[model samples]
Target chain A: MTLEILAFALAALLMLGGAAVVALTKDLMRLVVGLGAFLLGVAGMFLYYGHAFLATAQVFVYVGGVLVLVVFAVMVVHRANGGRPLVTSQHDIGAAAVAFGVSGMLVMSLRESVGGWLPESGTSGSSIAQELLGGHLVAFELLGVLLLVALVAVLLIVGPGERR
Target chain B: MTLLWGFLWGVAAVATIAGGAILGVWWERKVSARIQMRYGPQQIGPFGSLQMIADVPKLLFKEDIVPALADKAIFKYAPLFVFGPVAVSMVVIPFTAGWAPLNTSVGVLFFLAVPSIEVIAILLSAWASHNTLSTLGGLRATAQMISYEVPRSLAVLAIVLLAGSLRPLDVVAAWRWWWMPLTFVAFVIYFVASIAEMNRGPFDIPEAESELVAGYFADYSGMRWASFMMAEYGAMIAASLFGAALFFGGGWPFGGALGVITLIVKAILIMTAIMWVKWTFPRLRQDQLMSFCWKALTPLALVQLVVVGVVLVWL
Candidate 1:
């Protein structure tokens, strides 16, 4: 129990630290890093609460997918900027006040539904498999079909490539 | 106590990876040499088994070079990031009868999901190099891995489907001899995609040394550079062992003490096949690589998945 609490504290620290980096730093790359840390913290919380599937999905999608693309965008911009990425520190009181206000409002809004979002216990790997492969079987498997359709759609729309 | 145990197992897992990489490197040299009509490394410890002893010291003593323009922190730390995920994944391999080193409930899923994080580390290593070619290599690697991941996961999902559980122990426990033929196509797809995931040829466009000057780790030297190679060999080992356990039914036929030997032998056989395929195939063109993945492999993997699902339902 104490270990769990300590872990929870660590997750909280990561979330707070990440938010600070995102809010205070204007460097696009650092922002991406900060966002990654924040998303990881969120995933950690989900794992702590036994939302294993959600946590993994969060890491897979947000950290793996969204953040990577954002980093690429930033890198491309860096090349455009003649090497150095545009970065600054947002130390002004007005910006801080606005950021804090918006954050607090968001937290207040989420307070009621947070309990509903948190699962009673952490999900074990087996139960997630059963849930995904059983209850949501058709929907889940059809995702492959969805990907295949898109692949075919692109080929058809593009038509056979021009003879080399 | 639980944390202590986890730490100890983690150490054992890392040790297994290092040991496997050592053996794998020697085996790969010998096999590739035979394929080419060469003796390979004949000196030092009977057919070059101890070649790594010499290589390791040389690599370690070499001056570590960090590019002046490199992101020092990311550059220094990223190899661990690259190597660590594969090492952790090793912990979940269902070695022997109904046991894994870590034996987590979600072992199989954890094994598959965790390694995807390596892409981020690859990107960081490339970016930290501050070299255009390295960056380009990183991009190619990122795209290849992300693309191939689709079919790979679908292929492994077939095993989860068969076992009706995510636990590696359960997967092996539920395995049957007939599964070898039944999921054969899935096994092949899994094997091929695993090679791509490891960035071996014909999918090695990321580090196509002829073009990228060794790609993302180009700027790294000495021990840091060695880790990347170790990670690749380690990944090959882990994938082979996992695949052997899932599709080959691990060691059930041999049973008892020999079960462990059987599983290791199966994995080594798979690893040899991987090396054979690597040596034989020419690297694919970038466009060809992407096309082959999307048009050919992905569809075939899906068909395999459907076939497995149907047969499973019938049974």
Candidate 2:
């Protein structure tokens, strides 16, 4: 249990560091790298939670898909732009302080709440499946619909936009 | 027991990486040669089995060039970023019952996620190179992966619904009794999406050799290039393993140790089939690849997902 806590703490620190980099960096490419690192750290956290599945999914989807998209978009838009040193505005500092403060408070509250709650005994793979299928059936169905809508939207956007 | 399991798994992962890399390279060359109407590496040992081994040293010794304008730190770390996740993903892939290294409840999810991280490596490599062609290739790859990933995830969701568990072993067990039509559709979608996800032909627009001049890795050489190769082949092997576990019923032909062997065999067979497809088909244009994913595959996967959900809940 102590080892698990240490792992979680390490992952959280890495994630927070990445987030700080993303917030502070002026370079667009560096920001993307920071985001990737943040997502990777999140994946490590997921692994600590005994959800290796979620960790991998987080790595594959956010890091692999979204971050890559962001990088590519930056590359395309900034093709001609090169060697321009990134400049951070003073407003960003104020925004960062607010973000950090709110998150810190939330984390503190969560820690207190977690301390009061009784830990659930080992929920095996079978139990999780049962819960997903039997209890969370509505949410499961909705996810399918949501995915379908997203697919249609993507097609309509990408397909006609190019042709037009 | 955990330590013993870890040791075994480590050995399996290494062997899988080494074997898959060697075999995949040889197979790719032979296929490419046949496609070009020439015998490939026949001079090397036994149908060029040793051809890939000979090329490794050459690749290792080649100059590793860092473009003058590139981000030095990210550029240096990108290859490790690409290679690490692919190796780590091997843990959740169950070769047989009681064989997986990290036998967690979320095996399928874990398997699905590793390849996603690989895209980041490509994106970073491109950005770090600071070259137009590399950046363009990276953009193409990013778009390709994102468009295809939705369908890939949805298809896997359908399988998860049917299998009733995310564990690779459970997925195989669920498929033993009957091959449902929805499962078959899910399998087809998963297979195609996986191929695209791995950036293989005909969806290999990201690394279009002719147009992009080796695409994102145009500036990369030596061990850096080799790392990319390993990641790609690793993904191929990983996807094959996932496919086998999900659709073909992993480790079904035998029990115990032999079961693991059977799973490996299935994965290799699937890899070869992918290679065959790679060699046979012309590469798709970027637009066509995106359309195939968003327009064709995604809707199909969604339908399968709903069908599977309904079957599971109501029927």
Across A12-70, the per-residue lDDT of candidate 1 in tens digits comes to: 88889998888777656556668877988998898787777667777777777777777
Fraction of the real A/B interface contacts present in each candidate? 0.15, 0.77
Those runs of model 2 whose alpha carbons end farther than 4 Å from true positions after fitting are A1-6, A49-57, A84-87, A104-163, B1-15, B34-37, B180-182, B307-315
Structure candidate 1, residue pairs in collision: A50-A122, A50-A123
RMSD of candidates 1 onward, in order: 4.1, 4.2
Docking class of 1: acceptable
Candidate 1 positional error at B11, Å: 1.7
TM-score of chain A of each: 0.63, 0.67
Worst 10 residues of 2 chain B by lDDT: B173-182
Over the stretch B1-315, how does candidate 1's per-residue lDDT look in tens digits?
777888898888788888888888899999999999999998899888999888888988989999888768778988998998899888888777766777766677677877877888888788878898888888889888888888888898888889888778889889988888888888998999999999997789999999999888889999899899989998999999999988898787876569889999999999999999998888999999888789988999889889888998898
Q: Over the stretch B1-315, how does candidate 2's per-residue lDDT look in tens digits?
A: 555666677777767776788788888888788878999989879997887778888987988888788888888888887877788788887778656677777778777777677777888887788777887888788788777878888988887787778787777666653654557888888888888877888888888988888777788889988888888898899888877867777787577888888988988888888888888898988778878888999999988888888887875
* Top candidate by DockQ: 2
Listed in order, each prediction's TM-score against the native is 0.88, 0.84
